[model samples]
Target: MSPGKTASLQLPSFLHGTYRSVQQKVKREGLRCAEQYRKEGAFPSPRQLLEVPLGEVVVVQGVVDIQHERPVWRLYMVSEVLRDVWEALDWEDSSSVRDAYEASFLETAWGALFFTLARMGAVSAERTARRLEAVLRFWDPLECARYLFKKPGAAQTLEELMVDSCGWAMDAWSPELEGPVRARLESAAKRMERATREDCLEAILRQMPRALAAGHDLKHRQVLADPAFQRERLTMLDTPSFERVSGACTSELLEKLYDWDHELGLQ
Candidate 1:
């Protein structure tokens, strides 16, 4: 069978339900962790726990024989570090901080699981394509830029929005800091606009290393002394480990999605 047809045939049963199940599992785990935090007097309100964001909910199943122990440990450790930072900020009592931490924890745990599953061949290409589409429906860069810039009616694709955001960042007051950041964002934006969905997935993967490094630095900082913690926290989002998985799975998924779109002849 052709790659596209094979992918189309491999769609998992009830894609929405599978996604929701993962979300619920993450939520339950978050609540359990929050209760532990409350008992330790680190987290004040259980009600502050929020649902995981769509952008962080990648779907995969089964298990890989990867060395997940370290990644899992790192995930919770980052959460602990964030909790400390929140407390240091004197924002421990704030519901917003709690909510953000809850979401972060869920994303970390689930994201690790996802990469492991992907390595194990448990991530179906068709299902992944479907899930990515669903995620992008709400969390696409275009939507984010619109919300950030307060331009909901802006006539721009996600690629354009990304480029514009990069350009806007170039005007930051700190040239030393902003220069590199702006350069990276501009380069990434250009790459991402090349093939739309496929490039977007690659961009997401490319940013993972930077995000992880930022998280590690934040983890080591003296929360009380670091004035950059807040700004860093905004960028240190979402993780994971697995063996060398074939990139073919993701490539096929993207191709299948493109083919499907072409079939529909959508503009």
Candidate 2:
């Protein structure tokens, strides 16, 4: 009985299987580039995710031929490639502006496109002013007035700051959109919903790691019995098949699995 060496466990790898087969072939090349923008009936904008190669086209021979597509149907191709790289995607574009000499252009992709346009809003008001004039074409009006007055309470104020300042002034246009912009004078802004909801729930628990991988048998408990994931047992195993649970499971254990299931009540 001397053969018991069970201690070499190097097994845990699926952190979204290398972008989950490139996020399911970039979501089938963003639904066939959104059905060729609904057969030219329009509505697929952001310059059709940067024109050509509809979906799964990552042709980088020159430098960057990127297009992973789809954040709500390729949000105008991620708002025109972040408005053609908003001053080099400025989240205060680093190098600490040559250590405060003051001309760097702030990037972390404009602090992740200003925390995704301060959590965008407008269910109405003429369809959120035509989706904030198609998301301010791409942003620049004095960096959209320092991302709506340097982040007070980090978003959800004054029509989500006029639909993220008219979708960052329809893409880009700056003569510093001048006038009475005093309210948000940068007291070290940034915190838009706890850093964009923990960076979109850590990119969905690093692309789903099998509901916390121990024994692994939960192949989506019959779609969690389906009362829309029962009022929150920590967001009732957040679907796409029990998205690898354990994100520290509590919201009072998702309100006690909403009284033990009416199909896990997502009330």
Candidate 3:
């Protein structure tokens, strides 16, 4: 019910005009405006929306002015976002959580993407975002994971939390799972190639692998590379955060693309 009407965020003096236009777009399209604005390569202001693989599309849209719709509308919209996120996951069909993990390389990455999409509009959690102030403060996306979820042991990293929640991080990967696993990986590569920036990062990182198992299926479809090769970094899926090997990212998750011990395959 008039969702965009609630988005009266404070605009800097220069962005007043752009914000007005964005408002109109949001009004017409609701959350669907996220995709349109993404294509325009701007958010509340002019910013590259599709450049980063892990950090794409202005993440949370700096939601100021916590104006939510009526109770029923808010509830329904929340549920819709849940359903959309699940389909967005598009996890290869699996009989067990362990099978699901093997089918999709980023079992934990799926968790990260899932939480971000779910909290995209949660005002209370946004209020509690851990302030990273040395001199100036900013939102620490990683730290906020547990705080936002209001669970003490949700995780040090969202991926870990997701692994536990989905029970998908099991070390039960096997040879029989190869077909579906490669299918999901190729699917991820295809999405990165298209790079429509619809759901942006949430759409790509779930199936994204830490390493390439076999490029047999991927030799042709990576549309973003010079030879139209399969690579995530050259595309919008490339984010600086994904490159770093901190406590946030698992060691195996950063192995060579062709490295098979990657959690989804060998682990």
User: What's the residue-level lDDT of 39 in candidate 2?
Assistant: 62
> Who wins the lDDT comparison?
1
- Candidate 3 runs further than 4 Å off: 1-112, 115-144, 147-156, 174-267
Report the lDDT tens digits of candidate 2 across residue range 46-122.
22112211122111111121223312122112222222233332434423322221111122222223323332221
RMSD of each: 21.4, 23.2, 19.4
For 176-209, candidate 1 gives per-residue lDDT tens digits of 3333342444433233233343433443343333
Name model 1 segments beyond 4 Å from true: 1-17, 41-92, 99-167, 171-267
TM-score for candidate 1, please give it: 0.22
* Tens digit per residue, CA lDDT, model 3, 1-267: 123332121211211123334344324332332343335522222221211122211112223213322110111122232233234334233123222222231122222333323322211111111110110111123223231122322222333332332111111111123343323323332333343333333322332442232234433223322212323442433344332211111122323233422322533
User: What are the TM-scores, per candidate, against the unseen true structure?
Assistant: 0.22, 0.18, 0.20
Judging by lDDT, tell me the better candidate of 1 and 3.
Answer: 1
Q: Give the better candidate number (1 or 2) by TM-score.
A: 1
Cα lDDT of model 2 overall? 0.27
